[model samples]
Target: MSANKTAMGDIASSTETYPFEKDERYRSQQGLNGFAVKEPFLPNGLGLQVRKRKMVRKRKNVDESPFSVLCAWVVEHQIGLSLNLLLLLSLTHFFFSRARPYTSLFLGMSYYNPKSKKYTQGWEDMYFVATWIIIITGLRVAVMDYILKPIARYGGVNKPKAQVRFAEQGWLFCYYSLFSPLGMYIIYQTKYWFNLREIWTDFPTHTMNGLLKWYYLVQFAFWLQQIFVVNIEEKRKDYWQMFSHHIFTSALMFSSYGYYQTKVGVVILAIMDVVDLLLPLAKMLKYMNFRTACDITFGVFIAVWFVARHVIYMMVCWSMFSEIPHVMKQGCYNSTTGQMISEDGGTAVWWNVMQPFDRPGGTICYNNNIRIAFTALLMALQVLTLIWFGMILRVAYGVLSGKGAEDSRSDDEGEDEEYEEIEYYDDKIKSFDGTNEIVTRTIALPIEEDVNAEEMNLGLRRKSTSPTTASAPRRSTRRTGSARATALSIPGHSDKKDILGRIGCDKPS
Candidate 1:
């Protein structure tokens, strides 16, 4: 036993001086003899020669079932598929006489009078609106993914989350930029342009021009698609609030259209769309890191939001409350013939307070309860806007305090926390052809100081006692000791000293 101990001591001492012996020691410790790769010495005197063992991983075969393949293909080509469907429908509607009536129901405005340049609302308009919803969704996806994503990447929005946001804002900027002006132009043509009382002047018989009908339907389609967008996309902090807003907005538009109150709806849409243009512009600037532009755009957005939402929109809401009783024709009326009939079955022109039950048998007539509910929905929208405005103000305050602008409602990117830091070691050396070479071996281990020593030790011990380690040839302990000592001496890792000592690695003084 004494002789064996002396021989081991001599072997450990010789390993410290000789590079070849050290390499042999490392190979034995790692249990890699036949698998060990020999390389020429590096020109750098650092004596590094990394030999990474190639790991052959068999890739998992994905589900190639017909359903899975079809699903995958659909996901990849959804925009193309939607466009193709739209084209097919358009072609069928144009060329085929048999399909014309059915397709016309969904493809064009119902009750359109070219001579009068007006359109009357019908159940067919619902199908038309549904078709427009699909069209908007497809166009939105195509524009964002194909056009804006590349632009965002080019503009230094590298992170995936930032790129997504940039593309979303870019798409919104394009949409609102186009529609905001279109809405204003439509409103400008109307007799009720900025005139709140005129919204209720004609009531259900209010004539809708082709432009206004298309615009209102398309706007409604956009908001309905937004409901899908908020749900399908990555959720933000204000997701529920946004969800509620979209729902309410869609409901308000749909109810107004159904009740033939689109004059007020159009005015509300015109007022709301103007500020939407600036918000997305500001967000796009922010994502691109144009701090000055973002701040300026955001400031403009705030001013417009206050005017459009708080002042003008509230005026429309108030008009619904105060003007409907006086301006609108009251009592149960024939919506088609525009004739009011009293309960005694006589044609009566009664200009009285419209109660919920006052509508005896009218096809379309607004009542007090319906007006209150409609007004309440508009109020609810305002409440939601106020909540968002508060968030915007908070962001504005942050900007004032020199923090620069940031969306308070945006989701925080914590993806970095999932990554582990890579640690490099230059101490691992190999000897080849009479020159010493350093070998770089990457081992993934948590570098956080809070990592438990016992867990780390367990991991190391498992690696040290692996099947490969067990089959390794005997080697000098001195080289292994030196490597461990180097690891222990790593800066700011004093806590690891005792763990290294306990694991047969000497602690450096």
Candidate 2:
């Protein structure tokens, strides 16, 4: 790369006349070509003296203190504050749930205890959820900070961002490894099988055991925490898309749990979470600057993502469509047994299908409409996952083609920017004549590009070209070159009249 420097320098220095002369003239008139001074080019009568307006922001009051500023900051970041509050609530719930086996209170609302052998509902269910959130938080923190970070560092990942990402991926991997199997086991035990219509015929009525309940709560809290964490972390190009995803997935899981669709919910959770484990690990590798390994893992991630999200989710949709009507025809409520009976054996029926508990005299009611709504929502979730999959494809292409070495899809930083400061020392020396001589010595000083300089360049680009393509110059690939060398090597540098003096290049004769 360095060998091409001389060729690039020749190209930059060879020409005096450049393209965009009209652009430069127009820019001068518009004050886009370095700061153009206002002058009377026409007759004095036609000259206009326009005054520059100074923007004055209101000053802070002297009475304001640091504590007040801190409070204001907290208030401004409402989402972050809300998440913290929720975490505190979860922790409180955990302590109470442990201390008292089955009872807890929040905001003066006593916990609701489900009838023995009945599904969890009301306050007891919500209480259990809070407790499980705390447990998941503890597990996630333990795995990410302590176990995964150290192991990744030992395996040659030294960058802090990479370590953090690896830890997160490790947690995901560990979580699904434990939970997905259990979810499968639950489906097997419930006899839901692969038939979609079976869900309607034998909809879950049994009270959730501690393990399945914990799983649902953990799934809910994990994504909820992600919503908060992602906002506070370095923002990516698709930040909002990911934010939407976390919200959707979290809401869907919680709603499914509330609706007593835990049997199907477990399957969805298992399928959706498996692919996520690999993506972060690939990104972590990319952050660690391991190109080959990252590409390999990314390839694998793509394959797994397709199978899990598209293939498996398609099967889920198919089953729902086929099974719903079959169960609807035969479904009937049994008041004595508190179960829904159908032609199919042990079908997990939804609560909506049975007669309302309050209306004891009403005939067995059927509300198959809720089933349609559920199917649509589930389909919507799969569609959202597909949208994210498109982004993943773009990233994978970038990695494989060497077009984007850093994951442009991610915004994590592993290394800090280097800062070099040169200090000048001044000392006085007394001569034989008793006259004091002052001497000052300063070593090599690092010059950094002005932050606003890029903005100004962007303005110039916008003025000279089609606005759609206008941007600051592309970042240089060579990271260790001198500023002067960089200036000489940039494409179209010779055509940029305003840049010559700024970069210490000689004016063409």
Candidate 3:
């Protein structure tokens, strides 16, 4: 590839004027671009900025290069070439991987387990993280050197390794699948624990008896890791993306486990195993740097478990119980039989405050129609919605703020402005051998430049849908020599460590 560098340099030097003129106007007015990524805790130390690459657009129409007549065809229609390749790659990954699941998963088992309480499941857990590490993190130097570099042809048109992006995405999905369900259960289990405490006079000793203590420990460890993920680790990694995968799937799992353990009184062994699994969390916490942010987070965690756990869970339980007849019936179980004798199996707490008579079948807990439905609807809508919607609002805020970068730029031509540090833009690009011509591509963000820049370093692209296209823009001038000459390694220099290993280029900035 370096052999072509001279020719590419010649092409760059010979070009009359770069199509992308230096624009410094919006450098300081980075409301959308700057605000969305900065780590509130780290201040200026290590901000997480995402420079999105625009997409590889399908050609306006295939126009063969005029130079193609004189020499071998240099395919310029990236989109057309890309679409064809995507179909092939997609088919291969789908069918071939499915055909040899064990091989693809590095001898791991992948099955659905609803009652699982550990971060990593069983035998499948081994394969899940192992194959995931390979795909997302990429094969070690050996595989890339021997296999990938030899047979691989077109990388993504304007971007880097397409496989890296695809694999990373999949790895992240798997990570979320592994942990989020357990995390949700942790939160759900707390409800029953706190509720049980309300009725028991000796709450401390009562909550920590043989099996119950183990249950609480599993619940705490799983969710404590989650709280770490939600607030801190995600600053670098795709905690939310991982959370998203499990959140939807766990909705049912959490409810089922909640009903099973708290209402029906099972999940003891499952809870103990979860404790053994997450025992590593104690070590994991010491690995992170502690600061005021960490202090506040831990403080809140203590308050939630020790204080709020006692108070909030009870109120949440009582209120949520009034909503659902089946759950209410289930929770008020016979200690001797331990059977939740209810015909229905919706969430335990299903009441409405605004309209009491409008339960899911218009059914009432203990047949108290108007009163039951009203409380249930109110809890689900008011309380649960706040928990759910607050999450949605934060993500929406991140994405929307990033998109509105252009709108927030000021017109001051002479004012000096400093922008927050964005993370490495082209870190996705890896060194490739001449045997394998690496390529990268992203969908175009569709934002035309409306402002100027002060520094020559224009972020390849900011956060937008299809950012890869913006990374390596299409220059009108042609190259005179070997096209793949310049050795561009994705920047990996980070003053602050990326804690959880952020995933993918398309994450919300």
- The C-alpha RMSD in Å for every predicted model, in order, reads 15.8, 16.2, 25.5
Q: Score residue 334 of candidate 3 by CA lDDT.
A: 24
- Considering summed lDDT, which 10 consecutive residues are worst modelled in model 1? 478-487
lDDT comparing candidate 3 with the true structure = 0.30
RMSD of 2: 16.2
For model 1 the local lDDT of residue 212 reads 83
The candidate maximizing TM-score is: 1
How does candidate 1 score on lDDT?
A: 0.60
Clashing pairs in 2: 196-319, 197-323, 201-347, 202-347, 202-348, 202-349, 203-347, 203-348, 203-349
Ranked by TM-score from best down, the candidates are 1, 2, 3
C-alpha TM-scores of all predictions: 0.65, 0.56, 0.21
Ranking by lDDT: 1, 2, 3
Runs with alpha carbons beyond 4 Å of true place in candidate 1? 1-75, 343-362, 402-407, 411-509
**Span of 10 residues, lowest total lDDT, candidate 3:** 480-489
Instruction: Encode model 1's per-residue lDDT on 231-317: one tens digit a residue.
Output: 656565567888999999998887777666788888888888898887777667665656556546655777998999999988888
Mark the regions of model 2 whose C-alpha exceeds 4 Å error after superposition: 1-119, 204-206, 287-295, 329-366, 398-408, 413-509
CA lDDT scores, all candidates in order: 0.60, 0.49, 0.30
Clashes of 1: 6
How many clashes show up per model?
6, 9, 48
Clashing pairs in 1: 47-437, 47-438, 48-437, 48-438, 49-438, 49-439
